[model samples]
Target: MKFLLTSGGVTNPSIRSALDGLLDKPVDQCTALCIPTGMYGHPWVGPGVKAWEFVAGKEEGNPMVGLGWRSMGLLELTALPSLPAEGWQPAVRDADVLLFSGGDAVYLSHWVRESGFADLLPELTDTVWLGMSAGSMVTTPRIGQEFVGWQPPGGGDDSTLGLVDFSIFPHLDHPALPTNTLAAAETWATGLGGPAYAIDDDTAIVVTDGGVEVVSEGTWKALAM
Candidate 1:
């Protein structure tokens, strides 16, 4: 399996290059499936419009387009609770990459389990998994509470998909994401029971099979409990 896990989506030249390397082909030849289910946690409303309508209509301006991938398609996994698997499985199977947006890790993790996509991942060995923030967090065994003050609804399990063994603490030391500081990351790591990575917006952790590489134009650190 391959992954390009970022704090923010392709925010810098090094990250873009890393993604290009993961693609291995020309950017225009690659197809992507954008899963925006994570956004469900951060609902917003606009004048004369419902929150869902506002969010549903705003699929444009995704960073994946700027990175030069071709034919990006949107798939809202949160809405698949009632839909047949046939409706979404083919899009996922055919896509060259699965791009996940950032939001609530707990919320996204629940949808990932409910939508059956977590079970399907083992078969998608060739598809590159691209994640940002919460998207990145869900690939780990657990989402640390220090990273996001929110917990799973109803005091449910905080476990994630565990596609990757270690947790990722994104946006480290970022002024905009004040809670995601290096100090907090260190505190979180102490109880993680495994390894963790603190990556800034300009950095990404690229994993191919069992190998891991940190590609960045900014700062990052690896931690162990």
Candidate 2:
């Protein structure tokens, strides 16, 4: 699968162009499946109006589902286990992209495993995994304890899917999130024991065919492990 991982969802023209390249078609021609499961794991974002806004593509800071796609659908991970894989797997295979929203990576990763979605990823070769914030973070090896919030059932480590080789510290230098400064990201990276990136809202990390590239129109840094 190809990846267009971002701190913010297609927040700038550069990132949007990257998305277009990944899709190999216009945004209006591709189909998308929006996964809003991660928002529920976040205390401040889900099971309420925030969740509704995200699904409706009206969330103030996030610009994902609202993008013009041929068709847009929701894939709530929590409901997948109750249904048969045959019922849902086809939809996943048919979609051009999977849009993941920002929230708690740990919770999102848990459901990604529990819901059997992680198992499906290996087969979706042509699909793009478009991730925002925690959505992007979940693709890495670990999110670090600083980003941990909603713990998994019976507990687990800070580890994620490790789809990529490194870690990500998102939302760097945002005025509203003072703790998300570059210095904090650097401090967070030291304990990760692997390569990591600290990226602002205008940045994205693209991974296609095992090649990684940073697509940014804003500040970013690759912290050494």
Candidate 3:
């Protein structure tokens, strides 16, 4: 699967172009599935208005689901375990992209595995996994202790899906999030003990065929693992 991981959603032209490249066609011609399961696990953004805004394309700073597509639908991971694969797997296979909302990466990772979505990763060879904030973080090897929230049921470590080799620090140097500064990201990287990227709202990391590319219109820094 291809990845268009962003600190924020496609908030700029450059990142939008990168997404278009991943799609290999117009955004209007593609189908998308907005996964808001991650939102419920976050303390700051739990299941309610936030989740509704994301699916309804009302998220203030994050511009994901609002993007006009041929069709858009929801794939709540928490509910997947109760249903049969034949009931939903076909929709996943047919979709052109999966839009993951920002929230708790650890929580999202847990449900991804629990709902059997982890097993479907290999089959989504042509699908794009577009992520924002925690959505993007969940794809990495670990999110570090700094971003840990909504811990797993068995009390696991900060480790995530590890779909990507590096970790991510989202919302770097934002006005409201003082702790998300470059200095903080550096400290977080030190604790991670691995390669990582600290990206601002305008930046995104595109991964395809094992190649890593940064698409940015703002600021970012790469910390050595």
Candidate 2 residues lying further than 4 Å off, grouped into runs, are: none
Candidate 3 is scored at a TM of 0.98
Residue 213, model 1: lDDT of 92
Q: After superposition, how far is residue 34 of candidate 1 from its true place, in Å?
A: 1.1
lDDT of each: 0.77, 0.92, 0.93
Off by over 4 Å in 1: 43-62, 148-154
For model 2, state the Cα shift of residue 111 in Å: 0.3
Cand. 1 Cα-lDDT = 0.77
Writing each residue's lDDT as its tens digit, candidate 2 over 7-27 gives: 989898999999998997888
Which whole-number lDDT from 0 to 100 does residue 111 have in model 3?
A: 95
Q: Give the C-alpha miss distance for residue 165 in model 1, angstroms.
A: 1.1
CA deviation > 4 Å runs, candidate 3: none
Per-residue lDDT of model 1, residues 117-215, tens digit only: 877888888889998888888899987656454456577666788888889988888886677778888888887788989889889999887688999
